[model samples]
Target: MANLLIIDTATESCSVALKYDDQVYTRSEIAPRMHGELVLPMVEAVLAEAGIKLTQLDAIAYGQGPGAFTGIRICISVVQGLAFGADLPVIGISSLQALAQGLYQDKKQARVLAAIDARMGEVYWGQYEVDANGLMKLLDQERVCSPEFVTISDPDTSIVYSAVGTGWSTYAKVLSETLNVPTVIHDKPLYPFAEYMIPMAEYLYISGESYAAELAVPVYLRDDVAKKAKDL
Candidate 1:
């Protein structure tokens, strides 16, 4: 197993997690507008708690986002600097998918509708299903759209689906009615947590998907044109 460092500042919260010796260490705070100051400290604290240097880790995983623009920038800058200093590989995980993976771990459910409140009357949305391997896989295109514009194509009524994140909280009735199912409201994973990125990074690492420090990037699903994941 690869020792990994994870960083997420793609929203109001700032968090860091370190996976070493098959154990995970994490720290986070709901510190909006403080990502620039809090992210590095959280990273330092996790590394100290794990009693390891940055260079000892196998890779650095980051929350590549469709979130607060400044928050995403902070995370990417930190990850690139750390990866460059440690000469380690870099991997990016989607903020929306992170919420689903976190829900899968916390709720132990297979179906998830993860959304984030994208300002200017829109939301960053994605649906995820846990396969037999217990990994959350995106079911369709992730996109930036108004709540009314979101749709689920031929969803299975046989399975119970759960909704999470600020977007759901903001427009619960709209999403619940749109998905057309009995939905559970969860608030624990309103922000993407770095710890949840470990499984994904490990998966990508084994699949030989690592990148250079300069190549570490964010997934800003939003653009002048309303774009879909498949369109990217």
Candidate 2:
């Protein structure tokens, strides 16, 4: 297995994971507004436990957006600095996909409706299903909209879905009324975890999808909305 390090501060959770010697070491905490303080320490702790420096890793990965703007910025900037300093390539994993991957990791759920509370009376949403390779594959474009506007692009009645992330906690009734599909809602794992991102990151790295540190970017689904609001 290739050595890799992953970081995520996309939601209230701040997490870091390092893969070394085919073993994974992780640190995570659900501490909102404290991500800036917690993330680097967590990274240090995991690298220490893994007994390797950042330069030893094949690539670095980070949760790339559809989350709190500041949190996403913090994650991307940190990863950029670390990867640039180490001369390592970086991979950007979707925060929504990470949430879906978390559910798959814990419950082996094949179909997941992942959403993150985007605030401003909206949610960042995506539909994901496990592929033949056992990786969560996004079925449609991820979007940010009000709870009532959330949808499943193509519904499969034979398949039951799993719901995850903070959005469900805040808008379950609305989403339930909107989706019109059988879904088991999960109360835990309300935020993306770096540990779950490792598989996707490793796959991306092996596929030659990794990019330079300067290319690391955050994906805030509501950029247009934010710009409009700023103009107002």
Candidate 3:
């Protein structure tokens, strides 16, 4: 088992989590424009509470987005710097998957869709299906586009599932009027949480899905979006 550190400032939430074996220690705050001010302190708080040091961490995991351009960049840079300083492996988890994982408890089914409001009338969307072992696998590459045009292109739609994300909560009327799929909207679980990323981080760590500091990158779905993930 690895001692892991995870961070996310990719939305209205600022969160940090440290995981060892099966235990997790987390610190989070809901501050829209306060990512810069809150992230480092949050990380220190979580590490202190967990009795872990950055040097002792086996790896650092971060939410590489399909979320806010600025928020995504801040998280990547923080993780990159911390990992580099500690000489630890680094993993980038999908922000959308973290949001979907937050909805596991309310599961009407195993399949899930994660979306975040990408502003400019568009959303960052992705699909996933949980396996028998309870691990989630990505069903498709993530996308960013207007909510009016997003759809389930996959033909197999047997199970009823809940939709989790701020994008859906924000564009409820537009989505309802557009997509015909039956969904139980989860407004409370909309924001992506660092705690939700732990299990996936552990899996990736075990599988050696990690990289060096210079390899750290954010998955920005919008090409024309000026700001890179580091700007947050």
Candidate 4:
């Protein structure tokens, strides 16, 4: 049984969860700009509900960046502090990947184009393909670009894919024109949820992707020096 704690405040959603054995306990809210206030309490609530202590966690996992700057930092800072005090390891899962995982169902293989509304009329995007065995692999690295930027650079666009994340929803017309494929979209699944963060964190833990608390870092597409408030 792996005891894993997960959090995602990289988007408007503030969510936390604990995974023990085959059971999951989660707390989530779609309150934008409330990540700092809500994440820690949600974490505490989930931990308490599961009867697990911080030190018992095998790893602390977080949805690391490519979303709200302040929101991402809030989650990473908390995870770092908790993991450091507890002497636990950490895994940094991409917010985009977490969004992709949320689209998974038992019915069929999942092909997802996960992106976040990066504001400034641009987006942070990636492609993911999940196999029948329930393993998701990134088909593309995370990138930031305009919604007009299509992902399919090749001609073999044959997979039945789902367009997910707020980026797609917000810029649907631009994305649809860009991708040219008739996309099956779930507008609500764009944000990362705590529930999707656990299994991936567990897998990374088993695979030794875990790092010391201080080593965990969020990924921001725009360098601080390059970003202007006008972009936000």
Candidate 5:
């Protein structure tokens, strides 16, 4: 396994994880609007626990999001700064995918409907199924849409999908009605975590997908909505 450092502040969660010498160290908390204050210290804590320096990492990975605009920005900017200082390559993992991965880790759920309450009556959503390698793979493009319009492109009635994220909690009735399929709702992991991001980041790093610090960027599914919020 590569020595990797992972960070996420893409939802209400602020998390950091460091993988070194086959052991993982992590720190996480659901502290909304406090990510900026919490993330760096969390990073320092994890690195200290792992007894490693930033420059010792093979690469740094961050939650590149379809989440709260401010949270996503905080994650990306912090990652860029850290990667630049360490002269390390960076990887961007989707927050939705991380949610699905967390469900898989927690329950071994292979199929997941990951959603984040995007506010404005919509959700940031994606469908994921575990690959043979056990990493969650996106079934279609991640999207920002109303609860009523959300769907499963290839619905299998025989399969019991797992539902996760704050979106399900916020619009449970509407989303459950719209999906119209059997689902087991996971209430514990409503937000993404950096520890779950390790496998995906390791996969990407091995695949030669890591990039320079300057190339790291956030993925806001609703660009127009983000812009409007920024303007206001």
Candidate 6:
């Protein structure tokens, strides 16, 4: 059993989870602009509940995102510090893939369309197809684009796609009409969660995908736009 600590602050949500001895403990809250303060506490809480020090963890995992610019920075920076201080390797999970994994975990759906509202009339979106082992695999490249411009690559018309994340909630009808495929949407898994990152991290760690603390990075798709909006 691997001891894993994971955190996600890529959206409006701030969450932390510890995977210990085949079990998981988590703390999460939807707190926009408060991730810097809230994330560390959540991390401490999960670690305490798991009864392990930071150094005891196998590796640190984080939601490196195509989500909020500030929130993604906070997550990667905090995780970088903790991993560096503890000499732990790090694994970065995609926010879009995590959103798809969240649905796969909760809905048992194999085909998913994950999208985050990218603002400025666009979204950061990707298509995910789960394998028999219940792991989400990205079907195509993830990109930031308008709802009309977003397209699912080689989508299974025979299967119903599960539409997930904040983008769907914000543009339900338009997305449905735009995708030109049948979709089942649930607005609850609108943000990436640390809990979902654990499974992906498990696979990556076993595949020797962890990296040094300094290598941990964020994946903000609309950094320029997000920064300009922040300045305003």
Stronger candidate by TM-score (2 vs 4): 2
Give the least accurate 10-residue stretch of model 4, judged by summed lDDT.
Answer: 223-232
Off by over 4 Å in 1: 225-232
Off by over 4 Å in 2: 225-232
lDDT of 1 by residue, 87-138 (tens): 9999999998889999998879778889999978889999898988788999
What ranking of all candidate models by TM-score puts the best one first? 5, 2, 6, 1, 3, 4
In the order shown, the candidates' Cα RMSDs to the true structure are 3.3, 2.1, 2.3, 2.9, 1.7, 2.4
| Candidate with best lDDT | 5
Question: Which candidate, 1 or 6, would have the higher lDDT against the true structure?
Answer: 6
- lDDT of candidates 1 onward, in order: 0.87, 0.91, 0.81, 0.81, 0.92, 0.88
Write down the TM-score of every candidate: 0.94, 0.95, 0.92, 0.91, 0.96, 0.94
- Model 6 lDDT per residue over 1-232, tens place: 5689999998999999999888899999998999999998888888888787998889999999988888888888899999989999999999999999999898887888998998889889999999877899998798998898889887566778898999999888888888778799987688889998888999999999999999876787775855774565
**In candidate 3, which residue ranges exceed 4 Å CA deviation?**
105-109, 155-158, 226-232
Candidate 2 yields a Cα-based lDDT of 0.91
What is the Cα-based lDDT of residue 191 in candidate 5?
86
lDDT tens string, model 5, 1-232?
A: 7899999998888999999999999999988899999999999998888777899889999999989888988998999999989999999999999999999999899999999999999999999999999999999789999999998878988879999999999999999998889988889688889999999999999999999999987798887856775675
The parts of candidate 4 lying over 4 Å away from their true place are 106-109, 153-157, 224-232
Clashing pairs in 6: none
| Candidate 6, residue 226: lDDT | 55
Name the 10 consecutive residues with the lowest summed lDDT in model 2: 223-232
- Clash count list over all predictions: 0, 0, 3, 1, 0, 0
